[model samples]
Target chain A: MRAGERAYQALRADIVEWRLLPGQVLGEVELSERLGISRTPVREALSRLTADGLTEPHSGRGVVVATISAEDVRSLYEFRDSLDCRAAELAARRGDPEVFRALAGELLEALEGLTSDDDPDHASYYELVQRMDAAIDEAAANPFLRQAQTGVRLHLARVRKLSKSDPRRLASAAVEHQRIAQAIADGDPALAIATTRVHLSNALQHALNTKELAPVRPAAS
Target chain B: MRAGERAYQALRADIVEWRLLPGQVLGEVELSERLGISRTPVREALSRLTADGLTEPHSGRGVVVATISAEDVRSLYEFRDSLDCRAAELAARRGDPEVFRALAGELLEALEGLTSDDDPDHASYYELVQRMDAAIDEAAANPFLRQAQTGVRLHLARVRKLSKSDPRRLASAAVEHQRIAQAIADGDPALAIATTRVHLSNALQHALNTKELAPVRPAAS
Candidate 1:
């Protein structure tokens, strides 16, 4: 892989995983040396990161990792209320019902082992949710909306990784997911939007409950 | 100031204004010569334009200015319906009434002479709409939404520049704008969203009316 691409992936993962916390300074020279890369590649990585909102220009030199406060998350949910609802509505209006019907069935099946402490089923559960998101986007069939959602989801990923999910929320969220998928499967645009709004409201509450949350399940899992 | 930045702006303007037509190849070497810059800067400019959705990778080599068919405009407006409604609603709920109330008055005042063939009042009318947009963004206070909307608006700008405007449509649109401004000024979120939807529906019709549009007014104007 090219040095710049490799540097970007590594740094992005680090920032998302919170190995590099908010407000941490990233010096180009130091990162280049530590990552066994040259300054040019490191510079490229930093620029990409800055564009992604993971870092911002510092007063002295280099950049500091950007902060995402609780308030930011609140605003994000408010924004998501706008975006996610429309996506759901469009999916119901245009999507293949059988696809969502199958997803709803899988969501119900996944509910059984969700409360286990080891969380063995969490990965597949999260994967299932991602599949639902993909299906909705495909059904919506609006490239402009897809592009906009991509930007929002990146920051949501960071917030999700930081959030600590309890089994209770996960179980509740599964039922919400089932309802949302079913509504889409029924081709009920209004119901699809309504269910989506309920899910997001609950998700926001769970996200805010964590004060330095212990990472476990991903958002909406 | 930089060669790459300058080339990007020049190319972007050309593409948006339709001087660089869709399907026209943008060769790095050719653009470099035309813009009086080196290959590296031309490459950088192309990459930025691709990122901006103004251009796309060609089959053989280089890139072509991306196409926005009438169909693309339809999809774009569908996407805008989701985004703009939320923004207007947020503004009505959270924004100070005085700002939007003042804008409503200006919109009403500007209704006269809107049908003039010279279109002398266009620039200021459009500027006022822009100010209303800015006020909504501030009142909404969601950076994520702002970022997403910015991406959508770039493509919308291209579509807007391409479409020909008739005096009848422009006059009707002015009254619609006045109503939208009044709704927001009233601090009624539902009414704000409803008014926004009506305006977008009309705007979409105006945008798609031109088979081979003669440039006259901006999108909303």
Candidate 2:
């Protein structure tokens, strides 16, 4: 990639990973210095971030990362419930079972890998979500739906960053994903949609309830 | 509003209302002169538009107005279906019938106010939709749902602008809104959501079929 494109991608990844927390100001000069690029490229990258709703222009605050409040988290879930559930429903109706099976296998493996005791698994979990997302996107057959999903996924990333280390949540999510995949493979759109909703509702509640890093699964699991 | 804000709002209105066609290149100097503002303010306004996904920066082509395609419209409807249906479901779970009843009465009155001979009732129709949207937003209690709705509404504005001239479509929409209001007022969220989905699907299809003016529905309604 070109220097500008590389800088943009790196910045975007940081934002998505929540390494750049909400309400953090981004200075073009500073970013350019850090990325060893020019201000023009940094400015371009910031502009793209603004379009993605990850950053906003503040007259006094310069360009600050968009913050997510508890209310915002709730709001994100409400929309996620809508978009994700719809994707699940469509996946069941029009998707191939082979896709569901493949996604499920990948998701299960990712969950297993994250169940390790040594390092933090946020990056791996995020990647697993991308793979699952790719599966859903392929099944959805709608570009607009994919765009909406992308927006939702960004917000969920914020929630995930906030609710990191919660092993119970990850375990539950894996089981719920299994349910969703099975339903989709069985061509039960209603069931798949409903299962996805349940999963999101649980995740939202967990995000509201916890803040520190917790395990990917609980003692019981 | 300040000159810059005024220019921004005016240009946005024109774009959303379909007065400005897609893929139209906007010159900063020309717009500033037309709006009787300095180029600085126009540039700021364009930056804001770029952030809003209404414009894009082309490396060699200068900044051009973003265009919507048939695929964009289809994806938009799919997103809308997921969201509106979920909102309806939530409304069924949380909304008070008395609130929707009053809103339904107002919607009916507004629909009746449109004169059959008035071919350019697009502006009026847009106004009515805003009021209807207030009702929907109220019924769908999820904040995330509202935000998703906003994003979807922006895209739908282009679709509506493409199809707004069809009085038959408008009339059909009027009937659909009534049904939706009734469904919500009757405390049946599923029915309310389902009816709303039908309305959105039909409207999207109509937009895809027509060419002259893209029907721009009111942002909320």
On DockQ, the leading prediction is 1
What lDDT score is found at residue B84 in candidate 2?
78
Worst 10 residues of 2 chain B by lDDT: B212-221
Q: Please write out the lDDT profile of model 2 over residues A20-87, one tens digit for every residue.
A: 76667788878889999997667767766776677889794558877666776777777777778888
Candidate 1 lDDT, tens digit per residue, A1-221?
A: 87988998999989888788777889999999999989877877887787677888997588988788888888888888888999999999999999999999999888886865466549888999999999999999888878767767877888888767677888999999999999999999999999999999999988888645433322220
Off by over 4 Å in 1: A39-41, A116-118, A213-221, B39-41, B116-118, B213-221
Ten residues in sequence with the least summed lDDT for candidate 1 chain A: A212-221
Task: Give lDDT tens digits, candidate 1, residues B1-221.
Answer: 87988998999999888788887889888888899989877877787788778898886488988877777888889988888999999889889999988988888777775765456648767887788888888888888778767777888888888666566777788899888888988999999999999999999888887645433322220
Q: How good is model 1 by TM-score?
A: 0.90
Q: Rate the local accuracy (lDDT) of all candidates.
A: 0.84, 0.74
Candidate 1: which pairs clash?
Answer: none
Error of 1 at A130 (Å): 0.8
Best by the lDDT measure? 1
